[model samples]
Target chain A: DAGITQSPRYKITETGRQVTLMCHQTWSHSYMFWYRQDLGHGLRLIYYSAAADITDKGEVPDGYVVSRSKTENFPLTLESATRSQTSVYFCASSESLWSSGSPLHFGNGTRLTVT
Target chain B: GIQVEQSPPDLILQEGANSTLRCNFSDSVNNLQWFHQNPWGQLINLFYIPSGTKQNGRLSATTVATERYSLLYISSSQTTDSGVYFCAGALYNQGGKLIFGQGTELSVKP
Candidate 1:
């Protein structure tokens, strides 16, 4: 409740199904991000939100969707889960732009598996 | 788009040893950050050194924006320090987006 929190610590879904991961930050930061971590590629950003209702796609955002209806919550939805989409997801937030004064704070991360 | 590259893809060290990890960015960056992913898969921000030197305990970081590179120094590393270190770069006011390097996998043996 104090810092960033991610729901469904571990999840398993079937292909072609939809899954949603939730992220909530009590700090009410202005910036939020969603990233997926794979073995060889390290971590690639999925999407990021500047503020409430303002969202943009990141490097790998083809099958993912993100919505930030409120400043404290940013949720990522997988329209149709695929096997390649199974990876660890991390949610982060920051007060200002990413810098020493306002660095991004990360969540515990969610491990998702698609079968 | 900026590209981040890390050197010495893997490193092994004994306890109490010192190590330096390097990150090279392809282009100019206004913001740079270092993160440590522990054995438990927890990602923690070590520093946000955009263009200068900053230190915290045995950990210190330096970023040369002109050279498009950053260095992370760990002194007297412990077994608990074994983990993956990553450096990311981003443009100024780019809405909090970062291009992350592949990361350095450090293993400190006791």
Candidate 2:
């Protein structure tokens, strides 16, 4: 498909266990981002990558790690999932920066529950 | 960093009613976008109005960059329009990284 895809549409893991969320995009967009949504707080960015090897932290990056080894894929890892980390995770991508009229696109999102 | 704020945290409307949602940004931005998170949790892009106005079907949006705010209008609302509407923007120097607002939840009753 020519759109972004997220694996394990829904996931349930125990606290202290490690879980990885996978995201793949067919558009080869240069910028990829991971955001987690929760009640009251809304969607908070966790990490973003400008390229395969360039990544930066966003509003909420604690306890989470992200790596982009390929332009088409960006994965997020929770080293030790906590109950507080239970939320819906969204993966998004855009071509280049905001300047060229390229709007962001998001996958269906992954619902992660830590118990 | 840019801060985005949305008004009318929740709304309830009868089918065929029209309503408007507002978004305010803390500073100037290079990008502004509107999205609707469907009941199924899919984020669908509604508009990419950095400034000016744009319309699609029964939805329309207008961004007044100079004033640092945007507005989304939904006309003749239907049951399908019930969802969370979000507005996000990237700070001028921030490139494409978007900061999203808390969103306005809409419920349309037939």
Candidate 3:
């Protein structure tokens, strides 16, 4: 596909297990983001990468970690998954901040369950 | 941090009916976007209206940035349009992180 893709469309893991969600974008966009969607909170950003080797925390970054070693890929890892970490994860990409013809695009999302 | 609120958290409509969705923001924004999350969990971008009005097919969106509000209109709704509609706002200097509203879940019946 020519757009963003997420691996492990659905996952089930134990509370102490480690899980990694993979995100890849073909556009080589400069910005990539990881967000978790919960029932009442909507989509909250967990981490974002502006470029290769640069990353920052968003609203909720407690149990999540993200790295953008390559512009085409941004993967999120859970150090030790907790039951509260269960949610649908979405990956997004964009060329720049409010740039012309560079709207944000999102993946289909990965449903993760921490038991 | 910006606060985004959407009205009528849930909506039910019959096919061929029309509907309007509203979004309000707490602060100034550089950009506003409307998205539709289909039942399959795909977030499809509907419009990127920071200010002014835009239309695409049976969907149209208008954003009055100065007023810190935006509206999305769905005309002649179809069952295929059943999904969660979200409106997100990008802060003026926030590095493009989008603050999304809780969303309005729409259910269309045939």
Using DockQ as the measure, which candidate wins? 1
* Model 3 regions more than 4 Å off: none
Q: Report the C-alpha lDDT of model 2 over A28-97, residue by residue, as the tens digit.
A: 8999999999989878999999889899899999999999889999999999999999999999998855
Candidate 1 local Cα displacement, residue A69, angstroms: 0.7
CAPRI verdict (incorrect, acceptable, medium, high) for model 2: medium
Q: Model 2: clashing residue pairs?
A: none
Q: What is the DockQ (computed on Cα atoms) for candidate 3?
A: 0.66
TM-score of each prediction:
0.97, 0.96, 0.96
Query: Interface RMSD for every prediction, one decimal?
Result: 1.4, 1.7, 1.4
In the order shown, the candidates' DockQ scores are 0.72, 0.66, 0.66
lDDT of 1 by residue, A1-115 (tens): 4999999899999999999999999998999999999997888988988899999888899999999889999999999999999999999988877446888789999999999
Worst 10 residues of 2 chain B by lDDT: B89-98
The model with the greater lDDT, 1 or 2, is: 2
The CAPRI quality class of candidate 1 comes to: medium
For model 2, what TM-score is found for chain B?
0.97
**Model 1 CA deviation exceeding 4 Å by range:** none
- Say which candidate scores most in TM-score: 1
> Number of the top candidate by lDDT?
2
Per-residue lDDT of model 3, residues A22-100, tens digit only: 9999998998989999988888989988899999888899988888889999999999999999999999998875854
